[model samples]
Target chain A: MITFSKQQLKIPKLQRPVYLVTAGQSKFDRAFPDKRTEELCIDSFTMAAQLLEISPAELKTYIHSCYYGHFADHFGDQLLGESVIHDRLGLDPLGNIGVKTGGATGGSTIWEGMKAVASGYSDCVLVMGWERMDEVPTDEGNFLISCAADKDWESPLGHIYTGYYAVMAQRYWQIFGKSEDSFRRTLAEISVKHHGYARFNPYAQAPMDITVDDVLNSPVVAYPLRALDCCLMSVGAACTILCDEDTAVKLTKNSKNKPLRLWTSAGTHTLRPADRMDMDIPLLPNETADQYKDLGERFPGGDRYPGFTGFLAARVAAHYAYGMAGITDPTEDLDVVELHDAFTISDVQTYEDIGIRPYGEGRTYVESGDCYHTNPNTGQPGKLPSNISGGLIGCMHSVGATGIMQTFEIASHIWNRWEEFHGDENIWNKFNRQKPKDWTNLQVVGAKRGMAISHAGVGSHVTSTILMDPDHLINKDA
Target chain B: MSMFGQVFVKNNQYKLKGDFHHMTPNMPIRNADDEWKLLGVTNPRAMTYMHSYGGEAVFFESLSQGKLMASRCDNSDCNITGTIYMPFRIHCPDCLAKNSVFDLTDIAKKSATIHTFMECQRSGAFNLLDKPIKFINIEFDGVATILMSYLVVGTPKFGMKVVPIFKTTGPTYTILDLAWVEEGTKEEQLPEGFSF
Candidate 1:
């Protein structure tokens, strides 16, 4: 059970909640060699701007600042930075802030943009993230991605990124005492579930009907992690526009949907594994002075648990986010969740990290069919339909653009805008032969509140943000 | 059509040859961290690759001489435990206190516990070894940092004791110079060679 007292549970009241007006993204797939990073950025930016009926000129005039996220500058042809690429998009010279936090770069960029608008630093902010992984070959790509790890120590020891996570999966299994066969099957089941969901996601990179047998039979890239269990390396871009509630109302007056209340966006990081042992709550926004005092009383400084693993960063980030959002029970409270699923094992682990299940029970949660939209256990709707957009597992893993894409999925569900972006039938058939079980009714029916969490590595850097239907937070009587 | 969907047919392209196909074995590039010097390991002809740990050259040098070393903070105020780091830290991560001009290198005890490990079905970076990569995380007693190395000879258990085994010949002065043997075997071999 959550332990914070009501007196200790204080969140700063926002004068005005930032609203995610609209979001858009380029189709996620293998290489898009003909299109440069700048063109992809433009596609996402213009597509988002178009959704709100704003012309390019109007967007430039209205957007006060921009944040661009990208990983591995060497991956693409662009030299200086992605922000310079944004300048090439013909937007006004409102200085560009580039964000690079490995995989969490996109999520961190959005959080930065949200803060800028919420603080009145900018009336409207544009956040775009993109990556072009196809420009380089797999080996070079592997080397470039490996650069994200602790280079002096970790990378030099032949620590491939996939191997690092596969080791964690192995440890996680050992801690829970899961048999090898059961552990492998559970991880495979997660992939099957994600592939099933991705079959319906218009932006997903790999959508196929695979079975546990297939995932088990797939070639193992890193011991326990099969090729199918890992996210596909793809090229894509995603963008979002964040504005004050007043600006959102004026801009979306004609649209039937209400904007979402950007509840909280926060990040945490620690490189040393020793210092990262404790699963303590991160420094959250909107905490009251009294709550701070209460926190000091409970988790006194210098007395904090230091043996906690760095993986706790993601759990703590999600915990503090849920606490600030007044959500005591994530499984019951959150309607949908979009989290970083770099590996199938990472997916199940995140279910526990986000508090949907207690630690070490993520495997049981998956086998229980609780993670699906239709729970096979009780024949009832799933409690929390996570990674409904297929997540990074089924969706493409474009290092920099993934976070914003997750945020966009949550915003789309809240706005009930899935139909507008569904993939064309021909393209879907071309990539994935078998049709999804059902795409006609694929949306999470009435999702009022949702969350999107992203991470850079084995809990080294994490960003968790919650977005709720403005009607739920604003209209108290309803 | 969506922005990306419209370009579906004509845009997708795949290249057969990798960008690293031409990289020489000694292609030098300063690591992203300016503090470190990096030399490329992939041979121009050989598709195999590995990285040289240039910044912590002293650590590997110590390994070559059969010494396990770790960096300890000289400033007592900087660390609560005054513990050592296996992959020595330039500064105190917790206190952010800059290490002295001369960092303290403490001799790590020859013994450690297997903190964690993974037996990979495939090898990465360093080409296929005779056996699957037995990546082990070794926790030296009292050292604050965990050392990641390969277990060359024995199966690893969660808390099994292990000892370092340095390469006697052709030492690369990288982590490749070091491996771990089960503590049970270390004692088994020690009594056989030395006479009282």
Candidate 2:
């Protein structure tokens, strides 16, 4: 069985604290043919500056370095796209580098920028990410995405990336879900919830009043994974400004924004799931070995740790993030989360992976309504609502911008600006979307802490980014 | 008409022949709503890629000979010794030693079962597999990792016994040359190019 070395298990320590002063995003849609990527990026950067009550030029002065994440150079048919964007943003002299980890490119970019500030290399940094999936047709896009898998082995099998992920959904459905119709409906409910939440967010795409049956009846891409069970293939840009304590205080002094403490940690597994070997489950602080000793017996085919049922990368990333941030239990400590809901089934899979719920019990998080903004069953606020910005399933999965979008979403709730952002008439008109008459504010009243999980292929790479109000630190020593 | 691209290795260098790329002129994309305004242009081009299998070349070549080659870490001093890899690891992941090739044709024929399987209804550009591809990840009796392959003869289900089939007739020299079929599948039942 595979095991971890002591050095590998050691918790990471940052030299100094990093803070997320402000964040922003451009309108997310299926395509942006009318605008260039640099223009979209400038729109997002302008909003980030606007949130700090400053102009883009004023904000550019504080940025010591830049980290740009654009997942597929082939999609844009342009390499060194970062330098072009940096030049367009008028930050030509600043050192900038590109980051790509498939779907986790945005989070990996943040992980790099966080280290830059935490290590005293840069007092202030700009983390920007965008994707241009519209350049290719749907079929060719699927082929390009499949290139992320092992080309010699897995990619040739239909050349569809969804097939690689569907195997895991099938395993989880049979073993944990027991192939129950109720479990299937619970999975569809996630689509309904995410799409429903999207109606209130002006920046969100695919805002539909779709039902669980609508999701169930959608075309099937793979068995047990329907068209609606998937995330939107989107094009967009998102950015976040991270800085040291002094820079953060100076940047957000005049604005309504609060500099939230930030911690970004990542973990990885075999790129191809076929290479996964049997190993003991890497326990989270909230999990114990005793709880999973009889996992195989309980779920029949659930014996193999992360065989086709779990994201070990997310589990390990959350482990390191929680350790570094001194969060003992996620469900009790954090107020909200934005999981990488690439698919509805993967959404539930992440609930288990990131310790929102235990293994084999992720469905309950949805079935019991704890994953909703307003628990439908009780009509009360959810224990810890997730994906209030509709997440990738309903918002946009623009690859490089997705993780940053999720972080921007969670930060809005913690800053008590969710309503102000989502309810503004000018914002809806700017994006040319009609405000839903039934739009309800989804702000968690006392959100002091939140997190976003950015993931790549079959758990190959996963980064957990945690943000908390400075005064609400779980561990004072941290 | 240009011939298909072909390459062969000689003296550790590639001997290339025929056309490797085809160029197509770009077409103007117009916006109908704005009185057919010029919006963008399509980039139409195609090129063949030459990829090397490197140390794992034997595994793909053996498929045409109806042989399933695996690799084993035979380092006696290594903590994890004699561990077999079906996907044919060039080097032992733990010890970093070059793995020894082990023929696994007989073992696969005797005992191979589907660990997890998926039926995909769609494919991407240039996909050769038929619709509703019965993708299966098979678990061998002694292999450390699972092998991903498509089922040819029968519908896939968890724990269903399967045996290997190879494209011995006209091998592609790629992973597509290796496939699986349900146990007791007859020779005639195999796909035209594949055989047990």
Candidate 3:
């Protein structure tokens, strides 16, 4: 008889000292008539290289692997472009990965990079995500997003992306008895807050100051979800440079900056529509709900189960990352957070899913104003400030690039470099009363840790990344 | 040829089996959510591929038809199918599919439905506009499949079922050849040389 040993039963720890040292992004905009996917990625790559103060050539040498996050054609050319960049820089990479995860492409790519580094397979990896929405016609884009749903059932019913989410939104209303006005108010607050933050983000796509009424009165795309409540499907790109610990120190020591350590990373998925029947209705206590339930039993656990979709995956992934990183209280332990706010409801749902609030209470977190960069309800200061960099709503979603963009934002905030590049003082002023001019002066706030949550819109993908201040590296003594 | 025959010929044809193992309430074994979770953690790459393919079908459906349509539910609620992707069946997708026979005779004359649709500017071959094409979910009086098609018009409103006009020439004589829609008023009769 063959038996497994306890030692073998354990999952191996990441051998390399991976550090998310530098991150960069391109300006997000509505798909322009002239832009192409290659151009967007090239621009994002250039920005990423510039931020690291490294030439494309230097980056090539250190990059053991590369992953592309996109959902467009020209897959061959996209890979060739990376190779050409490497060859031009005189660096030979061992592996090249071109993975597409619908809207979760960016975050998925980042997770892949982190996995490569964590698995002791590679020392340094470069993850790039880009999308050129303007290159295609509007009908085509709609078709692309809709494709994310069940083509046989939902597609046959003419269920567009918004309508799909609207059904869920409507179901939530039925169970919670929340009025359309309440949903609108919550969405408006989120949109307005993110827009205000976007004013400082030069790379953001649709930055505007609008009232709650604007959101309420916005064209109803699908009943409760107004135009403003939804995120803009724009074109953009983002890149991150991750390396092992020794390499990070060597590079940082040689440079003038500190590196952001990779605390942990995780991803999870749940049931699709067909599988929903096996799920329990009225969501029994300790019994999680999948994507489907009888309309009558849609809202389970009331305040305990937040109505937002796609949190199960995110929450599961976050649990693993927190456990790995030794983080117990995410709200108190993490200094900053950035979530995939594809829609206003997503942000609220994510809060509860991530354990920040008790289910139905996500709205209270938003309404009480404790979730914002500046707290309104309690003058005493908020524990966690989420999506401060405008999130997907303000930043624009380039499908595959959206997840990575959220990760990059969280990494940048933790590193305290957003103000330097964007020249936006609001984030610093709101979070840090007295802004520090340089990275060193930016006090390592209360916690030396931070976390990020990313999810794909089709309601299938979820990933979480934990970033720790390099100073808090647990194995430094080793 | 009739609209039904044309669509069947134009789009890529594949047979999806109902024989595949499915999660049902009686089984009570494992749920789709559990399977999704397992797949998500253990096979993220596959999940990504699944989603990417889902995105691809949207473009395929649009270029095939000038109008959008969805499948009707054959089960209990008669509610339209929401997020369940292709090859999976759970009953009624749109108002129950039982005893319902779809006819495409009046597809060209029916007004387009806007309640289920989106404007897409990415994916597939065509790049006619600066932004993505306006994809609409049009429900006609005689079709079982809610045709997913493109809207030549700028903005679409709910309950508007515009008529589909096909292109004169194309390798595949699919519904997508029905290139644009005639807006403002629903056509009372079929065009010349057309039959129900």
Candidate 4:
């Protein structure tokens, strides 16, 4: 495995900190046969322009470069999507590049856009991502996604993408020693929670009031993985406008949309699963054991596997992102999160992998109702309430669009735009599972620091990004 | 108005009413597809290409000769001289130096212990030969990388000792030239030993 020691990969101190001025996304759906991929990108780009309070033409003039994150050129006819979006938007042809990191494409593309502006290569860069998987047959789409795996060794050996995660889930079960009944319950609860959250999202693809029993009753696609445990193959797109600190201040001078400072972003990767033998149960070094006591307590209790978990890339990425943002404890430091949950197992594993909870105890966090939109006891959302936009589970999985949509959700929550845009009607409360009387919105009150983690390749590639309210980052003691 | 603004600008409350209402499953729109298809047009073809396996040929050539093989960087002045590669490498990945072609041709014994195994039910190549196809990652005694191949045994347990059973017929030049059977269980007998 690739080592991400502090001495080897130091926390980056940027000369020019980047900021997200505004972002937007089209409503996700199961199929968009009427619209092409380029049209979907244009739709998202137009929404972003409207939110920025600029005409499409005005927004075009400001963007010096563009990066389009698109997966599955095989599924669609839009291979030159960057050029297509640029030409369609009437933007000047400065430079256009396509970013493809499988499902991590959105996160990687946004990071690239930020780098372009941060390095003084451009003043403003437009980052957009999309996928149109529902246009093809579901089995064909599965084959396309399987192309991301090791083709010669894996794909030819009857190892589908879902089978890869199922193997990991089985391994996790072996290490944790959870009974089949308990393990099934844990997986079911995760699906039920995401579904509950999705009911509030108007744009969500499958937002029914699903129960734990419903998830349990769902057909098993693979051993230990039910159909409900997986994300939908939806069609959608998302875009973000990133600029330097000075440009952000200028853009948001008289607007309700406040700039969320891009505190730091980092990524780490290892392509193959077998290369990481120690991924199932990694031991925390003794020097940092005391610091991670809470996580240590969350250990599921096994003879430690004497190696790292497959989530090493995510840990390394999150560590770097948090380290540069000067956040030592993510549980206390982060206010909200939008993580990749392509599977129920991924959702649970991400909590531990990114230090939201301790390893092997993500089920505990879910069972405790910490991930609830509004806590039963406090009548408010918990600290770091996840998937407020219903995540990929509820919001739907549109491949390239998912990561950028995660970024947009956190930024919109930070801006607190729901009330301003939708007014104080509380339109979402009626759809809530409990339908609490005083619950207002999914946005965390007084939320300052938010993090977005996106990954792909059965946890081989990961990008962790930390965003903070500019005022809060400079004066943390307050 | 642009096509987008015209669609969404009517109001954000559009989905809650009119033609775009998102109903729950088992509602009015259950599994509906509104498509315009042109009938009688058949697109039947196949895509074929020759994949250059580069340095992997050294391993496969030995496999065709009824032997397993392992290769490593053997440049004396290079950084990773003894680092072994499973599928073979043309150059030393670490030092990026041209390796000795003959040094990568070492004969490997056909015995390894299973590191991990999975019973996969689907193959993208449409080649599922068994009810539940079993693939194993086996660790050769002296090799650094685990070799991935099919295990033709029933319910493989982790760390089970295995040996290769080569296909004397069919496409014998490829890595699919052999499937593994559990060690000491004979369905087919072989010569006691062979010269390298």
Best of the candidates, TM-score: 2
User: Using lDDT as the measure, which candidate wins?
Assistant: 2
TM-scores of the first chain across all predictions? 0.86, 0.99, 0.82, 0.89
Among all candidates shown, the one with the greatest DockQ: 2
**B118-157 per-residue lDDT for model 3 (tens digits):** 4442333232322444555454443333344556644665
Clashes of each: 6, 0, 66, 5
lDDT by residue for model 4 (A1-478), tens: 2223457556666667788988877767887645666677877888787887877677777788988888778766447766776677677557889988887888888888878987899988898898888645677677777878776555555536776666566556555526457766877877887776676565567776788889988876655677888888889899999998677877767567888887535555545564443223332221255443553344442323322234776776776676677776777777888888888878877887777777656667676767766665577677667887778788878888888988888887778774443223333332223333443456667777788888887776688877788887833421
lDDT of each: 0.68, 0.93, 0.57, 0.67
Could you give the interface RMSD of each candidate, to one decimal? 5.6, 0.7, 10.5, 3.8
By lDDT, highest first, what's the ranking? 2, 1, 4, 3
lDDT of 1 by residue, A278-387 (tens): 33443322222353334334423212222221255576667556665677677777777887889987877677666676544567777777677777688777778778
Alpha-carbon RMSD to native, per candidate: 11.1, 0.9, 14.5, 11.3
Candidate 2 stretches with Cα past 4 Å from truth are none
Residue A84 lDDT, candidate 2, scale 0-100: 93
Q: Would you list the rank order by DockQ, best first? A: 2, 1, 4, 3
Candidate 1 ranges with C-alpha deviation above 4 Å: A1-15, A272-310, A423-440, A474-478, B1-57, B97-110, B122-131, B184-196
Name the TM-score of candidate 3. 0.65
Model 3 chain A worst lDDT window (10 residues)? A276-285
| TM-score (0 to 1) of chain B for each candidate | 0.60, 0.97, 0.37, 0.65
Once model 3 is optimally superposed onto the true structure by TM-score, how far is the C-alpha of residue A76 displaced, in angstroms?
12
By DockQ, is 2 or 4 better?
A: 2
DockQ, model 4, C-alpha based: 0.16
